[model samples]
Target chain A: MKKLINSAESLTADALAGMAAAHPDLRIDPRTHVISRADAPVPGKVGVVSGGGAGHEPLHGGYVGRGMLDAAVVGEVFTSPTPDRILAALRAADSGRGVLQIVKNYTGDTLNFAMAAELAEDLGIAVRTVVVDDDAATGTPDGTPGRSAGRRGTGATVFVERVCGALAEQGADLTAVADAGARVNAATRSIAIALTACTVPAVGRAGFELPDDRIEFGVGIHGEPGLRTEPLRPASEIVQDALAVLLDQLPPGDDDRTIVMVNGLGATPLLELYVVLNEASAVLRKAGLTVAHTLVGNYVTALDMAGVSLTVCRADERTLGLWNTPVNTPALRWGC
Target chain B: MKKLINSAESLTADALAGMAAAHPDLRIDPRTHVISRADAPVPGKVGVVSGGGAGHEPLHGGYVGRGMLDAAVVGEVFTSPTPDRILAALRAADSGRGVLQIVKNYTGDTLNFAMAAELAEDLGIAVRTVVVDDDAATGTPDGTPGRSAGRRGTGATVFVERVCGALAEQGADLTAVADAGARVNAATRSIAIALTACTVPAVGRAGFELPDDRIEFGVGIHGEPGLRTEPLRPASEIVQDALAVLLDQLPPGDDDRTIVMVNGLGATPLLELYVVLNEASAVLRKAGLTVAHTLVGNYVTALDMAGVSLTVCRADERTLGLWNTPVNTPALRWGC
Candidate 1:
């Protein structure tokens, strides 16, 4: 594969070193692979942490800073971090106000974070976990046979981290921070479409090949099979299809205010993301939803996939207030 | 070509609409394709304006906000903005304190922006122009034949816009702002290596292609021919070669502080960019330059090319101060 990397084996470590050099404000643990705030474990404040695979950058690591994640346990590309690494992040982030783990809804990540939470609690550190299952594409309605796994978390992880990070920074207790994260998770929904598959550095090939005239609808972040592959269409039609699925899953009321995030999976240009955002915003407005805050960029991504995910989070005064709170992270920084 | 665009003819307009929707704080003139500050022409503050082809996004448009460019005149992909369109942006950004035009050193961009400056001057608006020529790869020493064109401007335009933007926002006169921009441009050097060619939406194919195991060093943003095609090398070696050229072009003193920007050409992942930055930062430190500020992302891009450019701006205290000034723009926002 034509990638700007030394080798697949050293990809994660090399990137971590680069992160340390690029952001002096962040302290990277070479041994544990935990990226923590340079000034971590703030006394009397709840600590927030999250992590998953490595390819989706600016996600777990880029979000670590003064107002977002206290620590991020990084895994290899498309792989979950081990329980020990998660435990290490938890230990590093605990500041006596306890810690909240924002775990995405993936089998490996969910189990690993849970085990780590238990490990942290055993060490006398109070810990709470919030599972984010906001991807409406993989979700089913209540009482479905496969509904137990729930929706896979996607772009809403950013929303959860931002809002929950604000709450934690405000010296909220672990339970309160966890509750805020869960609340944001519940209010958020996302669906993605992939124009191309991303190649993991180690794989040296695309995860899947797409036909020239076809697009995958409801694709997952890790190239998981989407609901189906459909004939390629115009951007407006593609956007409408994704929006319909999202809105059907989480219908809005007239008075509902929503935060819309048009997230580029990977390799999608900002130009295209803006186009998708324009169409998505228009549809949301036509449906009588007030777009309170808009975030359009590559927040979450597959390594090099050309696609986008539209996320709509139902915002109330409390959620919007927390989102407006100042965040000074590498990826999502504003109002500070 | 696999792209998320409606049509080649409408790509620029669609992207502009998306930019307007994504950033409400910036004003986009549909008629002239000038992206300006919503509140422009601030009395007594010198205005800063820059523009070029539309493909290098977040370059001109994303830089328009409170502390950056007063206006950005956009053209069709890889094509210079018309003289009339550039004149429109100049007029829109003219304040009583006058205006500074930052033009990249591409032939068409330089000529058109210069013509626009002359037109603006005829209309009674003060205009001073700074032509950025910082690409070391395309440079020839003192008295070489054809040296009149100097070097092509590349990634350093971001540095020029930022430093000069701050100076203009601080009420510097047109001469002062233009001087700062020129100084930064002179002190900066950049070199890029491309692994793949980016396709223009209108072209419907890659600009060029290389063998599977070869890379083009010093490739221009518009896919201009580079210095040479070399066998694919590791990231460290690639970075070292690019840095050697940049450093040789603009050597630094023991105590000189510099800002390092690792910019991705459209499709390079952040993970790889950071890895490259990690190596680039180390070589600079070993060479005894103190990296004062680090920017790692796609600031300037070539459509969807998989490559990166490294820009090192040797900064004095004044340049660093200006670089640190608060900027609240769509593409680059911090310390607001």
Candidate 2:
């Protein structure tokens, strides 16, 4: 792999060191790989924390700041953080009001975060968990081997974190914050298409190989195999296909409002992400759904895969209010 | 080439449409491809404007807003914008206070922007220009073939835009804003190494081929041939070599403060960029220089090339203060 790293073993640690050095506001523990706000445990405020694999940067760690996440527990690339590490983040972020854990739908991440929540409860801390399963591509109508896994969590995790984080920062109780997160998760859906596969640093090879003339549809964030492979098509067509699937799965009413996010899976250019957003917005507007807000860029990524994901959230008054609330994290900073 | 573009001809327009849709706060002109603040001609503030090829996104367009440039003139990918387009931006951005043009040191960009400034002056709008040439790799000694070209402008353009934009927003006259931009440009130097080649959409192929086990040293932002090719090395060593060249070209005094920016060229991951920043910060500190600030990420990009560039700006009190000033734009928004 032609990566700008020292070695596979030191990738996470080195990146953490860099993150700590770059962001003085974040306090990164060397041992546990937990990144938390420097001034944590804010009195009377519910702590908000999230984590998953490491490759999808600006995700958990980048969201750890004043108006977003209080802490982020990081793991190796495409690997879930250990339960012990998650527990450390919980302990560090607990501020007396309570703590809310935002876990993705990945099996390992779900189980580990659940365990940490249990451990926090064991210590008499009020902890609530919200599992996000927003990926429409992973939806199995019925009887399937991995149907129990549910839809794999994807880019809408940012929406969950942002809305929930804003609510928690506003002194919302743990239950309210958790409910908001669940609400956002339920209203959001995402679908991704990859033009190229990404190589894991440790493995030094791509998880899968894609022919130059073809593209992978509904690819997961971790370079997982998508639903199927098809011949490459124009950006407008690709976006239309993704939108068809997303809208079919989560149809918005005529009076409903929507927030659109066109996320790039690392290596995709912002220029192209905008193209995808342009088409996606047009499609939504033509469908008579009010496109309230739009976000375009590489918010969540799969290492260095060349792909883009379109996420549509059917926002109500409350969800829109929470999303519009000011956030000042590294990745999603605005309205402050 | 695997890219998310509709066609080479429609790339710029499509991306601009997307940018306009994504950032409702910014105004985009479809005719001339000019992205400007929605509320331009800010009565008393001097107008700051910059532009170039379209590939290096979030540069000119993304940096247009409240405290940054009042307008950005976008050209085709890797191609200089026409003089008429530049003039349109200048006219749109100019208030009674006059306009300041921030042009990079490319022959085409310089000539075109200069022509635009001349046209704006004839149209009764006062204009000042700041030409940035901060790339250390293309530097020539006393007697060389292209010594008159000075240096190729690279990542330091962001520093120029930020400092000068802040100054302009403070209601500095055109001359003062131009002077600040020139100072930032004069004090900055950058060097980059590319691990892969980037394919321009129009070309449908990479500018050049790079061997798997080797890297192109001192590569230009436009994929211009570097000084030489060398065997791939560790990130630390690559950073050290680039820093040696940068410092050797623009050495710091004993009591100088510096702002280091580790920029990614398109496809490089933020995780690796921070890895580079980690080492770059260490080297600056060990040199006994005060590292006042650091910006990391893909501020300046070369399509989708996997490479990193290190930019060091030797700053004094005034420049440092200006850097700390709050500016809110699409790409570089913080401290607001």
Candidate 3:
């Protein structure tokens, strides 16, 4: 129960200040804990805004830049950003093209972002909101499959957030942007595994206890325990377990094109992710589906959990192409 | 030494296969270990390629998409990608426009990418290379800030990799791209702090040890030891200590604009990063340097080490603008 910090209460503020010092290209509105590119309000572009609790680095804040998100409103560690702060971010990211809010499906996130969108509309700024409900297994207690993960967005949300942001940057109107987001939500499915528990800075203890040589499947980003626990298996078997659940949640299809994402839950290495990808791909192929794209990395991490997640998106040509579009954020960049 | 895996020898290969399955858009050239977007050779775009070892997730491989890098070559573990793999990535990303290689400034990365560029030239493809040497505190064993490491690349490489990739994606020529990369490398300086050691999967043991209430400053990504070990200080003091080393490495000036980055080595939470950021900004402002932009997240990660790193870049209008450019990859997305 030890960490590097001055005081438990001062953790979030101190970290935000460090971020401002580290990345000069990002405009850190410390007052609101919102991050936007220094040269925000790009002429004629639809401003894209996204946020959630802290702990999931590079997801909301790190994705702030040109192609991904215009502004990211961060909450306290694993806590939702207050409505006022979210509104402020919406206000800042807004342009004549309008603003789109990428909200994870978590209860607090949805409520706050929804309120912020309403507030933006009250200000005569057109705003649309998309709630990422990509976590197929949500709201369920630990060790349950097909049970809801209680609003956990998981890795699939990364696609929902970034793809929507990308389209917004391309000047897509709020409706189109929201529709694109919904399209991804409808197509994407995620299942995560956790090898170790994370420790919230304030808490100063492991989020959960995982027996050595054991792993959990279908864990949430906020250390929400997990769906089930089992003995550690080969990377392939772990991939199978996660992918089985994900594929089952996806629309039944044979030969349908899908985008496969092998995401590390923070601590897992690229090699492990690749191994998970191999097994996940085999599952997809065995199910008679074609994997049109493969993305393996730490997209939506859960601190240092040392595990991986599999996300399968049933993508069409447009969604796939947009996935190919360029985005310049700290954690990801390429196709722009 | 307690890791959950069936075998360590087959880790990399198995992980690659899993990644291919999960993200179908990524084309995994297994033999070459070069990952590319399935729809590569995007019409009318200059191709950009990057690569290195397998441990760094979302780096060269995760970055291969629409906007950021056109392709990425992968190697085993922390080792550099082979010249042949780089050549394959260049060819895959090539769209008749010249190819640019964005390389980190490690010895292995430099030599391998250099050789690959020559090989690409021999193949009659226009290829250029830009190496990023952002670390200001050099000569640290393990290429980290100190010893007790096994080849660490602190997350600061994100600055050079993403910035360079963003420029290249915008159709910047090889020379311009390389120049921009070099500029960032020259302006940026990074230092890290570690709380606990990370164990490479193959090694199966922690790289180093720290007392329950102690902190190690100037640590590296690969679980390297640190330059200074002291009683675990407040997050504020940690930020100050890192800034002391990083700023000292940079050219002193009150007039220069700076970009701040607080990077997590892997396991450190977002809350801690913000804590570190808070203190860093105070110190920077006191130094009379205006903070321009900021990026805080897990950019370059060590293998789930409990640590964080700080990167400060002297930025101007040009660098800041480039940082905002659109990039499309699994991890980052900006201008769509």
Please list the C-alpha lDDT of all candidates, in the order they appear. Answer: 0.88, 0.87, 0.73
**Residue A12 in model 1: shift from native, Å?**
0.6
Q: Give the TM-score of candidate 2.
A: 0.98
Question: Model 2's CAPRI class?
Answer: medium
Q: Which runs of model 1 end up more than 4 angstroms from their true locations?
A: A141-148, A251-254, B141-148, B251-255
Residue A279 shift from truth in candidate 1, angstroms: 1.2
Retained true contacts (fraction), each candidate? 0.67, 0.63, 0.69
Candidate 3, superposed: residue stretches over 4 Å from native: A2-6, A15-50, A62-72, A83-103, A107-131, A139-151, A162-183, A253-255, A321-336, B1-6, B15-75, B78-189, B249-261, B274-278, B284-299, B311-336
CA lDDT for candidate 3: 0.73
Residue range A100-138, candidate 2, lDDT tens digits: 999989999999999888888999888899998888888
Counting clashing residue pairs in each candidate, in order, gives 0, 0, 103
What's the true lDDT of residue A296 in model 3? 64
lDDT of 1 by residue, A1-336 (tens): 889999999999999999998888888998889999878888888999999989998888999987789999999999999999999999889988889999888999999999998899899999999888888888764413134577888999999999999988888888889889988887888999999889998988988989988989999999988889998887988999898888877734335799999988878878788778878888988877878888887789898888899999999889989888899989888987
Error of 1 at A179 (Å): 1.5
List each candidate's DockQ score: 0.75, 0.76, 0.39
Clashing pairs in 1: none
Deviation from native of the Cα of residue A27 in model 1, angstroms: 1.2
